[model samples]
Target chain A: MILTVTPNAALDVTWTVDRLVPRASHRVDQVRERAGGKGINVSRVLASLGHATAVTGLAGGPTGRLIRADLRAAGLRDELVPVSGDSRRTLTVVSREDGDATVLNPAGPRIGPAEWDAFTAHYARLARGADVVVLSGSLPPGLGPGTYAELVRTAAAAGARTVVDTSGPPLLAALDARPDVVKPNAAELAAVTGHDDAHRAAAELRERGAGAVVASLGPDGLLAHTPDGVWRAVPPRPLSGNPTGAGDACVAALAAGLAAGAPWHRTLCEAVALSAAAVVAPVAGDVDASVHRRFRTTVTLVPLEEPDAPHVH
Target chain B: MILTVTPNAALDVTWTVDRLVPRASHRVDQVRERAGGKGINVSRVLASLGHATAVTGLAGGPTGRLIRADLRAAGLRDELVPVSGDSRRTLTVVSREDGDATVLNPAGPRIGPAEWDAFTAHYARLARGADVVVLSGSLPPGLGPGTYAELVRTAAAAGARTVVDTSGPPLLAALDARPDVVKPNAAELAAVTGHDDAHRAAAELRERGAGAVVASLGPDGLLAHTPDGVWRAVPPRPLSGNPTGAGDACVAALAAGLAAGAPWHRTLCEAVALSAAAVVAPVAGDVDASVHRRFRTTVTLVPLEEPDAPHVH
Candidate 1:
């Protein structure tokens, strides 16, 4: 079973409009809502893939109740800690004319010291039987950058493999805890290591104690630096739909592969195929199974020779 | 005591930002939420003014729960009927740079036929002790234009005064029910009557069986055509801050006056003064007591003779 933590969960609402005009009233044609956050997205994909995934995080107020109900209705196991403040909502305006997505995200509710303690206590108990633990998304206000670092250490202490997917100071801070895998998109990798090259940045992150580094390069595909070898995987062709959940799908594949003790190169192939499939689906954390099947055999994984990498530090 | 009915109640959310740019992400500086709708706003003001106001409407799901919780926290009386669908949310983006408010209003949840019957049953029970019943805001989907008309007839049958504040077909339909009062802002009056002249349009509405017509003329203040007489009330000067709740405040005053059996001219003056004070406050249904007191004495109410109306229908 995989345990996923989303400290700053959101009730994601998507409004479909014919066109988006600033400062003008829009008559939304359709509205779609789901429980969402990085770790929640990861758990949703894992659950859909027939994996037993339990979600634990902080939720509160009406929005929190809605999130919990959605989880239960979807038959995904969850143990969300209650907090005082209302959970945040993330709004996405999907233009029906051009299919462009404009997102408005709230910073989410603040977590008090007591609430943080409560979450950690609950997390400790839930982490006990988890095969792998994934900590994802932004930290709600009041939690320090080291919050994920501490959680990663706790999971590691319990002999569980850990994957961290976050950016900025929190991502930088969590690297010191030596998570089994750290997934950073190209932009996030550049922002953190001050290196425009994915290989160089991944190497730097690995030096800071990441066991393996997977860098998502959007349309360019997936690049991974593991203890066994460095590999790159790309889809047969670029598939276009909505790229919102592609990266999380990649993380889902990586987590699933680690749990199954799959070979690193095979894991890279699965991650690339799953992410490409996700881009063809409308919502995040969802993949077209048929597309995944086609891409699984079509995606190519090529191992990189260490001496040929000029950007490697 | 005043009873306010809001079938399309909403969870109103306000997000404050430095500036608003279309298609660009914004970091909201502040967020405020409250239960809101025209009747709800009227009830809120009536409660603040020490009037006993009981609210009855259709509420359901998580958003409805939050609205009820907020009303309870504010010490307002409510008996909202439950439905299967969730209540809607209305968002207001207040740009602090120029204090401009951009509003996004949803059509609200669809009220099934069963839900509508459930609401009418609850409303009839609550209307028994009410001095006045105010039907306000838009009708949700699945409710006909005659919903307010039916409610007005029910309230009148219960020996309670009826006030309808809405526009278009619904307003036109309810006037035939001979509601004690009907209030429409200038735009709504123009839309329904095709007349830009407030007095003429209001007189026409009164002729159509509305016992009284109170037309809000924006900065021009309030104009009324009633069985007692014709009256116009204006503040000493144009007071502006946030005009979101000014009309609701006017409705609050009208409900209060009808419950007290005050003179029509005095009711017009009070409505104008309260509305002016409401405009100077940040949130709807809230008034600066000192501002209200000053405006109450200074707002000029003059009787308009029937012959002085050049555009009389």
Candidate 2:
């Protein structure tokens, strides 16, 4: 079983307006809302692929109740811990005229120290029954930068492989815990490693302590630097659609591969295919199944020579 | 006691961003939410003025729960009827750079036939204990244009005077109910009567069936057409702040005057003063008490010789 954790879960609300005019009033006729966060999206993709997954995270107040209700409606296992503050919400306004989108993200609820302790204990208990634990998304207020590092250590102690998908200080801090795999999109990788080149950034992340590094280069595909070897997997073709959840789809495939102890080549291929399929899906946390199937076999994997420095210890 | 009915109650959410750039993502750090709607705002102002007030309307789902909670926190009476659909939310994004605001309003939840029946029954019961029943704001889906008319008739049968503040077809339909007072701002009055002149529009509204008409002309002040006489009440000077709830404040003062059987001159003076105070308040439903006190004795009241032909029955 794979356990996913989203510290700052959100009730994502999308509004469709005839046209978006800044500083003007809009009457929105269509609205769509769903439970969303990086880890939840990853778990949704994993569940769609027939993987056994349970989601555990911090949720509270009325918005939290709605999030839990949505998760239940989606048939996902809920092991969420409760807090006192209302959860955050993300509003995405899409323009019908030009297909433009404006996103407003509020900083999530502040987590009390006691709430963090309670969540840590809850995560440890859930980790005990999981073969793989995936920690994703931003840390809400009141949480330290080393939050993921502590969770990774808890998962390691519970004898589970941990996949960390976060950026900045959290990602950099999680490295010392030696997570089984770390997946950062190209921008995230550069932000943390200060290297614009995906190859150097992935190598730097691996040298810093990650057992494996997978950097997702949107449209360009996946770059992997693992103990087994270095390889780049490109999609069969560029797809045109929403790219919101493509990264989560990539993490889902990576977690699945890690759980099954698949080789780098096979894992990278699955990640590339699933990510491509997600782009063609209408909403986040969904994939075009036919596209996934077709692209799975056609994904081109090219092996690359190891970096000159060979920084791996 | 004054009872205000807001059929389409909302949880108004405000976010303050450094700047607003269309088609870009914004990280909002400050968020403020309150129970809001035209009727609710009226009730809030009335309550703040030491008037006995209660809010009765249709509210449901998670958003409704928040609305109820906020009303409770504000120390106002809550008589909201429940429905199955989630209540709507209005988002106002304010740019700190230029203080420009972008508003997004969603049509409120659709009320089922049974829910409307229940609300009608609930309102009738509340109206019986009230000296004034105020009907305000838009009608949600599943409600007809005659919704306010039906409520006005119900209030009359319960021996309660009604003050209606609404626009368009709803305003037109409510006129024949012979509400004690109908308040429409300059734009709303123009839209319903097709008269650009406020004096002509108010006279037309009174002629159509309103016992009295009070038209709020922003900055210019209040115009009242009533059985007693025609008068214009202007503030001592222009004050600037937020004008969002000024009309609601005007309605609150009108309802207070009706409940106390105050003469038209005194009522118009109070209405003009309160509206000006509301404009200077930082948020809707709030009044700068000092400003209200200062303006109350300073408002200029000019008697307009009846429009060539008197239209009052």
Best by DockQ: 2
Q: For candidate 1, lDDT tens digit of each residue in A1-313? A: 9999999988999887777676666666687899998888888889889998999999998789888988898888978899998898888877789887767777889999999999988999888889899999888888999999999999988888999999999999999999999999999999999978778788899999999999998887888989989878888997766666898899899999989999988888889889988888889878889988988888888788653456454
> What is candidate 2's lDDT per residue for B234-281, written digit by digit as tens?
999977667777889999999999999999999999999999989987
lDDT minimum window of 10 residues, candidate 1 chain B: B304-313
lDDT (Cα) of model 2: 0.92
> Could you give the CAPRI-style class of model 1?
acceptable
As a whole number from 0 to 100, the lDDT of residue B219 in candidate 2 is 90
In order, what lDDT does every prediction score? Answer: 0.87, 0.92
For model 2 chain B, give the 10-residue run with minimal summed lDDT.
Answer: B304-313
TM-score of 1: 0.92
**lDDT, candidate 1, B57-155, per-residue tens:** 888878888889888988889788988888888878777898877666777788898888888888998899999999999987889999899999999
